[model samples]
Target: MRTLLSNIKVQVNPKIYIKDPETSVLGRKIIQESIILIDEIGFDSFTFKKLGDRIGSNESSVYRYFENKHKLLVYLSSWYWSWMEYRIVFATANIADPSEKLRKAITLVTEKIEDDATTDYIDESVLNRIIIAEFTKTFLTKEVDLENKEGFFLIYKRVVNRIVDIITEISPDFPFPKSFASGIVEGSLHQHFIKDHFKTITDCNDDVSPTDFYLHLATFITKQP
Candidate 1:
C-alpha cells in the first residue's frame, strides 16, 4: 500500500484523491508507477526491483502486478503506440485533400518523434532505432503471415498501413504500388529517427535537422509526378 501510493504521488496529482490515497488498490498503483519509473529511468535501466524500490515495495510485490520486465515493456510500448495511433487518426481525419493529408501525416509523425517530453522516457535516438528495427522485422519483412510475427509488430503494422492508405490517396497516378509508396514514407521516417548516423556516411550540413530533412522529403513526395 505504501509503495502504491508512493508511485501515484509521483505520476498523479495528490489533490485528485482526498483521503486514504496511500491505501488504494495495489494493481492500479503498480502499473502506474511502473510506467512512471520506466519513463524516468528508461527501459534499459528500468527493472522490477528498481521500480519496487522507488515505490517502497519489494521485487516480489512488483511481480504481482507484472510477470516480468519484458511484460512491462510490452505494456509501455503498447501504450505509446496507442497514443501514436490516436494522434495519427486525429491528424488525418478532417483533411480531405490527399496531398494535405500526406503532408499532415508526415508532420504529425515527425512532431511526435521530435517531442521533447518523450525524452524523459527513453533516449529518442535509441528509441527510434529500436522502433525502426522492430518495425522492419515485424511488418516490413517478406513474410506475409501476420500470425508468424510477434504480437508487438501488430501496432506497427497498423501505423504503416495508415501511412500506406494516405500515400495511395495522394499518389493514385504514381506508377508504383501502394505498399511501395508506403515503404518509401516508412523508410524516410525511419531515416529521420537516426539521421545523425547518415552524416558519417555522407555529407549533412550542421544546419540540417531531422525536421528539415522531413520537410524536403515531404515536398519531394508532394511534387511527385
Candidate 2:
C-alpha cells in the first residue's frame, strides 16, 4: 500500500481555498499551525490573527490561502477524507470477500487514527481530532446549501459513497445503503466523542472501541435479507 499511498495527493475542492496550500512554504505552515492551534483552542475561539501570531506571520498571509477559518476547516476536513479514501481503496483492494472488505472499510473510518509520517506538514491524527470536534461547524450554517452546490463537500461525499458501493455489493437485497453507510461514518465520530466526554451514553470505552461496534454492525447489516 505504501507504493500506492506514496503517490497520493489529497485534493480539496478549489472553492475551499484562495490558493492551494500545498504549493508554498508559508501556505503549508498556515495549514500545519492552524491544525495545532484549532486543536488547542476550540474553533469558536480560533482567529486568523491568533494563528498569525502563532506562526509569526501576519493575518493577511493566512488569508491568502483561505477566505476564513470556516473554509480552512472545510479544507482540512476534505483533505482528511481524501486521505482516508486513499487508505480505504488500498486496504480493501485485495480482499475477495465482501464482508471482509466491508469490515476493513469500517475499521478505517471508525478506529482511532495515527499520524501518517509520509505527509510531512499535515498530521492526520490531529486533523482527525479536528474533524471529530469541529467538522459540523463547516456545514451547520445557513450557507450550507449554497456551499454544497459549489461542491465544497464533494470529497467527503465521495468517501461516504465509496462505502455505499461496498454495502450494495454485499447487501444487494438490503435497503438504505446510503443512510447506513453515512451513519457508520458520521456515527463513528459521534461515538468516539461521546465515549470520551459523555461516557455514560456510549458503550465504547478503553477496551471497546467504536471500530468494534461498527464492525459488528457492518457484519450484521451485510447479512440482512
Candidate 3:
C-alpha cells in the first residue's frame, strides 16, 4: 500500500469544484482544513468562513476553490471513494482467491482508519469519520438529478462497480452482484453510525468488531442463492 501511496493524487470530479484545489497551495489548504473543520463541527454547522479562519485565509479566497460548502462536501466524498478504491486495488492485487479478495475489500471498507503520513495534506482518519457521519448530505438533495448527470458520484459508483466485478468472479451465478456490493458498502457505513449514536438499533455484540461483522455479511450475501 505504501508503494501505491508514494505519488498518488486522487482525482475528484471537476464539476464539484469551482477551481482545481490540487493546483495551488491555498487551494490545498482549503481542502485539508475544510475536512478537519467539517469533521469537528459537522456539515450543518460548518461554513466556509469558519474554514477560512482555520486555514488563515478569508472566505473569498476559499470561494475561489469551491462555490459553497456543499460543493466542498461533494469533493471530499468523491476524494474518499477514490482513495478507498485505490486501497481495494492495492490490497487485492496479489491475491488470486476471489473470496480472499472480497474479504480484504470488506475489511478495508469497514475497519477504522488511521492517518497516513504519505498523504500529509489530508487526515484520512478524520475524513473517514466525516464519511460515516455526513456522506449522505452529498446526494440527498433536490439537485441530485443534476449532480448525477454531472458525474458528481462517479468515483463512488466506480468503487461499487469494482466490488461487483469481484463478487461476480467469486460467485458467477449470483443474481444481484451490484445490489449486494452496494449493500455491503452502505450497510457497513450505517452500522458504524448506529453503533456510535444509536446502540440499540444494531445487533452487533460488544465483542464483535465491525470488520468481522461486515466480512460475515459480505460472505453471506455473496454465497446466497
Candidate 4:
C-alpha cells in the first residue's frame, strides 16, 4: 500500500506538485470534519472517534493520518493560516495599486472570519477562546521558521512585503514598515474575532465589520501625529 501510494501521480503536471498528495488530501478531509465536530461538540468534547464516524471511517483509520488529537489540532491550526493565505493572495493578485491591495487584504482577512461557518455550531465566546488560544497564538512559535512558501502567515508576509515594496515605490515617507504592517493586519483580524468583546468593553460600535475596523486602523496609521 505504501508503494502504491508512492507511485500514485499526485499532480498531472509536475509544475503543480504537492508533497504526499494522497496523505495531504486525506489530512485536509480529516481537518474539515474535525472542525465540524469541534463546532458541534465544542473542542473539549470533540474526539477522534466522533470525527472518524462523521467521515465514515473507524477510529484506527483516523489514527493512521493523525497520531493523536494534538497533531490533528496542529494541522487544523496550520490550515487556518494556509486558507487565509489562499484567500488574500487570490483577492489581491490582480490589483497593481499598493493601497488597493492593502484594502483587499483587510477585506479578505476580516470577511473570512465573519463568514466562518463554525459560528453556527459553536458559541461565540468558546470559539473566540479557541481561536485566540490555538489559531492566533499558533503564529508566534519557532515553527514560524517551519513555515515555507506553503503556509499562510509566511505567504501573507510575502504579500505584505510586496505591497510595502510598492508603497515604497509610491512614497518612501510612509511609515508603514513591513513587520509593522503585517502586525497591523494580524491585529485587525484578531480584533475582528473578538468584536463583541470590543463593543462591550470599549467604545467600538456594534456594527463594526472586520474591513471597517481595518479601514479605521489604516486611516489612523496613515494619519499619525
Of the candidates shown, which would achieve the greatest TM-score relative to the real structure? 2
Estimate, for each residue in 1-225, the C-alpha lDDT of model 3 and write its tens digit.
876775888989888998999899998888898888888888999998888789887889998988888899999999999999998999999999888899988888888888877887889999999999999999999999999999999999999998899899988888888998888888888888888788887865467767788787776755655
lDDT of candidate 4 over 1-225, digit per residue (tens): 223323433221111122322346565566556766776666668788888888887887777766566545555544444445555655666888766676666665555353344323323343334554456444455655554333434534554565466446445676666755676556655665556554664443556566676666665444444
Tell me the spans in candidate 4 whose CA falls farther than 4 Å from its real position. Answer: 1-29, 112-133, 137-176, 202-205, 220-225
Q: What is candidate 1's lDDT per residue for 1-225, written digit by digit as tens?
A: 223322322222222222222345665566567656655665668787887787787888766555566545544444445545666676678888877887776665554354334223333443444444343432333543543344544565566678777766766665654555455446555665455555564322456644455666666556777
Give the per-residue lDDT digits (tens) of candidate 2, residues 58-167.
99999889999899999999989999999999899899988888999999999999998889898989999999999888899999999999999998899899999999
Error of 4 at 209 (Å): 1.7
- What TM-score against the true fold does each predicted structure earn? 0.61, 0.98, 0.95, 0.62
Q: What pairs collide in candidate 2? A: none
TM for candidate 3 is: 0.95
Ranking by lDDT: 2, 3, 1, 4
In model 4, the worst 10-residue window by lDDT is 12-21
Reference-based TM-score, model 4:
0.62
CA shift of 163, model 3, Å: 0.9
Top-lDDT candidate index? 2
Return the candidate ranking by TM-score, descending. 2, 3, 4, 1
Candidate 3: where is the Cα deviation over 4 Å? 221-225
**What is candidate 2's local distance difference test score?**
0.91
**Model 2 regions lying over 4 Å from their true place:** none
